[model samples]
Target chain A: MTATSFHFGEGDRTLYGVYHAPSVRRRRPLAVLLLNPFGEEAIRSYRVQKIIAERLAALGAAVLRFDYYGAGDSAGECVETSIDGMQTDILTAHEELIDLSNIRRVAWCGLGLAVPVALSAFSSANVNLAKFLGWDPVISGSEYIDDLTASHAKYLADALDMPERRIRRELSMQLTEVMGFGVSESLISDVVDLELNGSDLDVCDDVALIGRKSSGAFRKLHGQLTSTASSVSIEFDESVTWNSHQALNSIIVPNDSIAAIVRALADGDE
Target chain B: MNERIVQFGDDGRLSGVWNTQRKNSNRPTILLTNAGIIHRIGAHRLNVKLARRLADIGFDSLRFDLSGLGESAPAAGALGYERQSAQDISAAADFLEENGRSDSVIGIGMCSGADNFQRAALADHRLSGLVLLDPHAFPALGAAIENMINRYLDPYRWARKFSELKLNAKTLSLRTVRSKSEFSEYGGDTDEQGRLRPPKAEFGNELRTLTKRGVEIGIFYTAYVQREITRATQFFQTFSDYQLEGKVTVNVNPRVTHTYTTLQSQNMLLTEIETWLKQRFTD
Candidate 1:
């Protein structure tokens, strides 16, 4: 399989990610356009996205993984990016993926914060979506932001090897940064107001919402979405959150989850 | 800095961000690669700062991914991953030239990236310069002793060192904790991906070739690499066969971690790199 990288959009914005083209010939050319998490979570889950994309491509699907606008290799700065803009980017990526691969059918999948964007895109998608896969999707922005803050606090406390009070004091006194990404009040407000369940999301033929047992919010969101959609399936995996400090670096290939999703796609094909 | 996404290479598989000034000059385009798994934004947006700084001084820069690393696709065969990385660097340079961005190109990167581009610069005359960050080197005996004294002498550093030396107590190796964990250039148990650096003999030969070809080189080392190379002058002594008198600039810093995680460390690094560019390439 060969992974290609390129940019396409208004004025050709600079975005970074790999396009994993299947080496083996497929009966039908099905493309997968992956969406990444927002901010530091985006950095954490990058390896996971690539690994998932590679696995999907090996299953005879063309996968294109990219950084959203104002993030990573994209043309602008991180603070410049928004949830709405990211949703548009997803739509744009979907169109670009189809054109690039020359494949009519495509799937939209994302991890963490990417789930909200994927949901928004799927709901408003002009073209029919083959599948919408969410791997430990974020159900509420309020919860997500809190998690971000807590994570940042923990990271800072651990990084400086200081007490929680000292870390809190430092954050309050100084412009607190999460990892390398500087967090802004407006950005936090925007994210907090977002709720995945509140969004107008449409269900496709195959909707596989997979998460770990420990992922309460995602699992609950998955159950609710699947129950209401009249179409969806359930799958379980090792509940390790790559967004945390422990599991970010190591590449834990979701072999079983990949097989499950592949099976579902194959079933959809039949 | 004005930025553009450039897709140039075999089948347009390679992607890069070309940061240039609106008003052009006779400056070279700097090509940057991922320091291991870290993307074009760099470990802590180091590449972004460096690129913008170069543009401020009328020079353009391109930060990109090597094949199978970061955003770029993997090579068909994993056996020649290092060879492919060299080719990727050359292709990025070719893209800049073909687009009329710049005829001269300088390759800059950290750790594995530094080693890979160093190899490329040794072979490709098109790359007129190299800014290597934390490329591996042997530590000299004298410098090792001096470093030990410096570490023991400083109270803050001394405390940190002594804290880690507590055998029974749970202690994190600063090497494994701060800069590494996630962004460690070389990770995992297996050598399946292959080594980023060339053998010692080949590296010496390449350094000689680079000097002979008149490529200006800037080699920067952080605390970790300082531990590896020991002395700043050891680079000269080890590569003494090559006429490195005016050809190479070496700075070994023990103040920063490998990835320059802190704002202060990152600022220091940018200052060092920008100063080097001004002296070597910028007119």
Candidate 2:
């Protein structure tokens, strides 16, 4: 599987992406647009997304994995990033992939909070979409932010909280930087607004939300999606835990998760 | 200053983001690679911070994936991981030279990344300097014995250590050994006691050779390695007949970890690196 790294979008704020092209002999009907988790989780999930792209490419379809604007290798600063700006990046990446390959049919595989990003990207766009695959989909933006806060707390607990935090002035912040990514005041407001909309993944028919059974939130989300949308649970032999402060530096495959992604992408093979 | 994604090397399989400033004199370039499998962001976006900060100071930097790591495709050659990584580094440097990006380059890596860069710097004449962070650990008997004795005397420290280990053990039990990078993190449950000594004889030889060649070298050792080797003197002592005082800059910081996890730690590392580059590589 061959992958090419390129920048897309118009002048100013060009985004970085790794596009895995189809095999030599033949190509499938679908190409995947892999959206990443927000903040540091995107960095943690970089390897995972690349592997998924390669596997999909190996199976005869092309896949494009991109960094949201103002994040990763993408242009712009973290503080300048907004939910709307990132959604525009997703739409831009979607169009660029289609133009690059001249293949109309596209699928999505969003991880964690990025599931919402995928939904919002194709929400209004009239694109040839086949499958909607979300792994450990964050039910709502507020819930995800809450979990992020909890993760931040856990990180502090796990780490030797630096004594340097004792600054002269109060730690009054207009925004809190999650992990290493700076979450701007506008972005926080945007996320809260997203949460208020609920976990309605308004999209085309095919939907598969895979979540580790161990997570109570995931179990609830699975039930909600199955009842509300054309969603099904993609199960693995063993449950996976993708959210841990320890995962920041490590590269993990989550075999079951990959297998689930393969099954989801292979659905529209015809 | 401009930052853009660059597809460098032969056949364009290698990928990197170039952060450059319009230059007249050739400033020393910072060559950054993934720390093990951690990717070009370094531990806690240290490389990104370093690159952008370097750009502010008019120094160019290209942080890229080494062959199969991160976004770069895997190398097809029969070369091992280390050699492939070294070749990737050389390819990046060649790109810089060809494009008139910079005439001088300084390689930076930590842990195994440092090992590969050091191996390449010893061989590659294009490398003007290196910033080795927690490069390698060897048994420094004096430091090891001193730490053990300190632990023996400080019962409260021992208790805290025991408690930390217990909590860590719980997390360790859940994690499966998946990748070679992850495997190296554990060190294979081997007895690491008295392991920090004189670094391999070759490391010292390379240091002496690089210093003689007028290559500015700045090495940072975290408390993790410092506890074992103790002080900067042990490094010179490791390689006898090599008086590196003023010849090389060796910082033994007992506050930082191998991977700077905290914001303060990351800031301190960046500041030290910038200071070193300003003093050592300035024309």
Candidate 3:
């Protein structure tokens, strides 16, 4: 697999992306667009994304992984990141994947926070998606916000060795940043409004949701997708933790998860 | 500021973003490397901010990922990571010089990036200045005393220390908490990802050589878990015989985390580095 890094998008909103070209040409060209999660999760999950892209490329699927305008090595600041912007980024990336690969069949694998963006984009995008895969999908936006808040508090307390009272005091202030990355209020409001339901999954022909382990959110999302989706598959891999302090700094290569994703993307490949 | 994506180095495997001033100038290019495994964007997009900041001050900066990290493809060779990193830094410098950007380069980084910056400076003469954040430091007498005093002054530390002492007494362990020598300079070293640290004396000699060679050095140490630099002047005081008075500048802040998790801390670092650059290089 050969990976090439470049910037793609319109003026002022140019985004950074890495295109992973397959080693050999397949009978029917297939491409996978990997959408990253929000803020700190994107940083933590970057290696796994790269690994999955490489693995998919090895199996003859061209993979394109990118950062939104306001994130990663892209052209904008973190404060500019929003749900609508990210949904647009997903569309832009999807178009880039098709243009770069010139392949009609393109599948998208959204990780964590990207799950909702991918689902939302599935309904609005002009191009037809071959399949949609969501890893550790966030079913409830309000609950995910709570999780982020709690995680940020825990990280601050543990990192600084602060008391619970001090932690509470720190969190009581207006939160413009989480962990280390800055987040916009508008983005927070947009994320808080997101709730995965059967409506979003109705447009997707093939939907697969994978999680580290089966949780309430997973079962709920799976049920919703199964109820309305044309075809749905759910799987679990317990090798990785996406939002833990212990796993944040480490470059995790969840072998089982990678294998599962590759199998899903290459299901119809010869 | 004008930003352009660059793919240089052998086989065009290296990837970086070049941020430059709108008007061309003969200023030294700043090369920012990867902070550990995080991409060229640095921790919390610090590198991107720093690059643009330098550009605002009429300086060009290239923040790139070393081989096998970020967008850079892994080299098909058996070279160790350290040597490969140094080579990559040299290659970045070469890219800048070849593009008629600048002949001299200022290397800036934090944590693992700082370590690599220092290592690359030793082998690459194109590096005119280095801004190191939380680089490797040997335990010094003053640092230990200052650390103890600071801990004693903390109200919560006493209770924590007492609990630790009680646990130690119950375990009957002679092992006192000390930074492990074999672990990485920043700690969390495992068999699969162990960090190689050079001896203090050897590192001191390297610093002496850099000072004699007239390389501008700014070493900033933060409250890292594995940091032994508890005092601001610990680097100079530890190697007092090296006479690094005019050659190096050291700043240690125990309140700041290794990655500068807060916005204020990030600003503090950027201001310190910017001030140091202005003072050292008036060109």
Identify the leading candidate in terms of DockQ.
Answer: 3
**Residue pairs of candidate 2 with colliding backbone atoms:** B138-B195, B138-B196, B138-B197, B139-B195, B139-B196, B139-B197, B140-B196, B140-B197
Ranking by DockQ: 3, 2, 1
Q: Chain B alone: TM-score in each candidate?
A: 0.81, 0.84, 0.86
Residues A1-270 of candidate 2: C-alpha lDDT, one tens digit per residue: 678887787778688888889876657878888988887788777777877788888888888998887777777767788878887888899888898777888887888777776677677577657777888777667767766765654454334323223220122343356666667888888886664122555476777877777767677666666675566676543533455555555566576777678777877332
Highest TM-score model number: 3
Please tell me which predicted candidate would have the highest lDDT against the true structure.
Answer: 3
| Residue A160 accuracy (lDDT) in model 1 | 41
User: Clash pairs of candidate 1?
Assistant: A14-A74, B68-B73, B68-B74
Residue ranges of candidate 2 with Cα displaced over 4 Å = A121-128, A140-143, A149-175, A192-199, A237-252, A268-270, B101-103, B138-160, B164-199, B223-226, B229-241
DockQ of each: 0.15, 0.27, 0.48
How many times do residue backbones clash in model 1? 3
Of all true interface contacts, what fraction is found in model 2?
0.17
DockQ-wise, the better of 2 and 3 is 3
Indicate whether candidate 2 or candidate 3 has the larger lDDT.
Answer: 3
Task: Give the C-alpha miss distance for residue B130 in model 1, angstroms.
Answer: 1.6
lDDT of 2 at A239: 32
| lDDT (Cα, tens digit) per residue for candidate 3, span B17-124 | 988664554778889988888888887778988988777667789999999888888877867988999999999999988888767899998878988988898999
